[model samples]
Target: MPGESELATLLRDLKPMLAEEEHGFVTIPIGSGWPQGLVPVATFAETEGASVIALSSILDGIGLEYEEGWAKITIGATSALSAVGLTAKIAAALAETGISANIVAAYHHDHVFVPWARRDEAMAVLENLSKVQE
Candidate 1:
């Protein structure tokens, strides 16, 4: 099925859910292969290195230096890649409360990463957005 593209509908249906496992960010320098048995939820290649998001425990076990203590919030709505304003709206709402939001758009949905300690607050913000939009 095609994903939702209308901004209002996207906001109304953003059933944000907090993941149970804590994740972390790690960067592997160019020319270095990924750590053995490391399963990354997401990866991006840049000029300096390959950025990865994976479970905190897995990253620690591999002895990789990473910024840990992040909580992942997955937007339950399947938003289209062409959808606009969703990220901005989410970021703005979270920003109002000083919550840092790092949103990653995948083929079907958007995953938001926020500081572990503020996950509940972030979820509240997102839930409020949905209610207001409804």
Candidate 2:
């Protein structure tokens, strides 16, 4: 299947789906062993630490204190890695309402992380954005 590249198509077809599992971003030192079954959706290397996404249960199971309570919004658009403005458009819409977005762009889909408490509102905003094309 072909991936979407146009900004308009990406926006109109975003079809954001909120994941049922609550997630969090946590940091561990570079040399720390990765816990079993703790599959990070993404990781980043920083000068001070290594960032990862671990399910809340995994964190608790491993006895690791984590920055907790973020929700995932998987934008259901097969957007090209080079697609532009999709992130900006979504971010801007959420920002206008004082919501914050942390985005993870993968090969097949873009996942957005929003404050756990605001997941419902974020879903509403994204749903409206998609309907704009209808």
Candidate 3:
């Protein structure tokens, strides 16, 4: 099925699921090549380095400097890549509670990463957003 593009529909169906494992964000310098024994869930190349999101355990073992303890919340709704305002709305909602959201748009779904300590609060905000849009 085609992904939903309507903002309302997307928000109404955003069944967020919090991942059990904690993730960390690390930046590998350009030309460093992929780290050994590390499986990254998401990666992005920038002028300075390659940003990678991987399991916290792997990052710690590799001794890489990284921001750890992120909780991944995957929005169950399939949002079209072209969908507008979804990220803004999510960020805004989380910001209201002093939570920072890092969103990643994948081929299948949108994932939001927030501080691990605030996962429950983030989930609650997302659930309420969905219900309000319903």
Per TM-score, the best of the predicted structures is 1
lDDT of 1 at 3: 94
What is candidate 3's TM-score against the reference?
0.95
Error of 3 at 64 (Å): 1.7
**Which tens-of-lDDT digit does each residue in 16-46 have in candidate 1?**
9999988999888998887897999999988
Model 3 Cα lDDT, one tens digit per residue, 48-115: 89899998988889887789589999999998888889989999999999999999999889999999
Query: Predictions ranked by TM-score, top down?
Result: 1, 3, 2
What Cα-based lDDT does every candidate model obtain? 0.93, 0.87, 0.92
> How does model 2 score by TM-score?
0.92
User: Sorted on lDDT, highest at the top, how do the candidates line up?
Assistant: 1, 3, 2
Residue 128, candidate 3: alpha-carbon lDDT? 98
- 1 or 3: which has the higher TM-score? 1
Native-referenced Cα lDDT, model 3: 0.92
Q: What is the C-alpha RMSD of each candidate to the true structure, in Å?
A: 0.9, 1.4, 1.1
C-alpha lDDT (0 to 100) for residue 119 of candidate 2: 97
Q: What TM-score would every model get versus the actual structure?
A: 0.97, 0.92, 0.95
Give residue 98's error in model 3 in angstroms. 0.5
Best by lDDT: 1
- Looking at candidate 3, the ten consecutive residues that score lowest on lDDT are 60-69
